[model samples]
Target: MTHFAPVEPDTATGESADLLTQVKKSLGAVPNMTKGMANSPTLLKSFLALSGAVGSGTLPAAVRERLAISTAQLNGCEYCLSAHTMIGANVAKIDGEELDGARRGESSDAHIAAVLQLSNTIAENAGDVDEADIETALEAGVTEEEIGEVVANLALNVMTNYFNVLARTENEFPVVSL
Candidate 1:
């Protein structure tokens, strides 16, 4: 069902399988998008590394999930939207209603709402977001450094979303209410 072949974990060989095993050990499963990324083992490894790096950064886990949720929404990536939705709820502990608002480009928290606005704008416009967008986030306490990190995070999700699209990656997680 994917535009590209998915490297099944049980059937994978060599380093691809190795990464799949690592994924399973870490997440209990190798997600479809990740499997699709295994089409290029290097890409799979780099993606995992970068994803982990950004996730382990100064950004709060909740905030990181929110930003990812917003970018997935902007890109209309059903795969990531579904996967991150559950993670956002179960792990990040963000409210269901609040998460739904992010899909609609809105949020109740001023700081998070500002971030959603900026991230969505960047994803939608390919980083051509105007000064006003940057100004709004800055006014909401997002620093210049944080803004850089936010942009990097958004870039990362873009890769996942497109890979999912190409892979037609099957949903491995339950879709929580947005």
Candidate 2:
């Protein structure tokens, strides 16, 4: 494991402390990824801002969580997978089967499956998908607005996935497997 210890909420200072405090207030605890991100206050702030904006988009919470899980799995970030699995179950009400399916970039729901396909493509291809790829998503009932949000959500998840993988961040949430 990398020596990047998570910044403890109690000992954190400046912008990091304030951010960690807010995280605790919102989630009732500080997730380790956020703590690790706190090592760079600007990165933490940017992530929080992007998360809030993307989270407020038209995409359903379940779909967002599914995108997050699928992207994380594609990036091979175990910390993100574990954290998002808990959030998917507790907050999004995603069932075990759906959670498992998301990790594989599959979903029984057609809409979710479409979004996941786009999201996975964005993650794996680094947002370099061709026009036909987007047309396929549009044909599946994904609106342009929804596609935009999907791209944002995929980017956001990828940021965290890369961060955790690089930082070797500890998992504060329940452990989940691919």
Best by lDDT: 2
Compose the digit string of candidate 2's lDDT tens values, residues 22-111. 888877878788888889998888898899999899998998988888988888898889988898999899999999999988999998
| Candidate 2 TM-score, C-alpha based | 0.94
Worst 10-residue lDDT window, candidate 2 = 169-178
Report the Cα lDDT for candidate 2.
0.88
In terms of TM-score, the best-performing candidate is 2
Off by over 4 Å in 1: 176-178
Write one digit per residue (lDDT tens) for candidate 1, span 29-63.
77777888877999898888888888777778888
- Per-model root-mean-square deviation over C-alphas: 1.9, 1.3
The clash numbers for all candidates, in the given order, read 1, 0
TM-score of each: 0.91, 0.94
What's the true lDDT of residue 134 in model 2? 91
Error of 2 at 27 (Å): 1.8
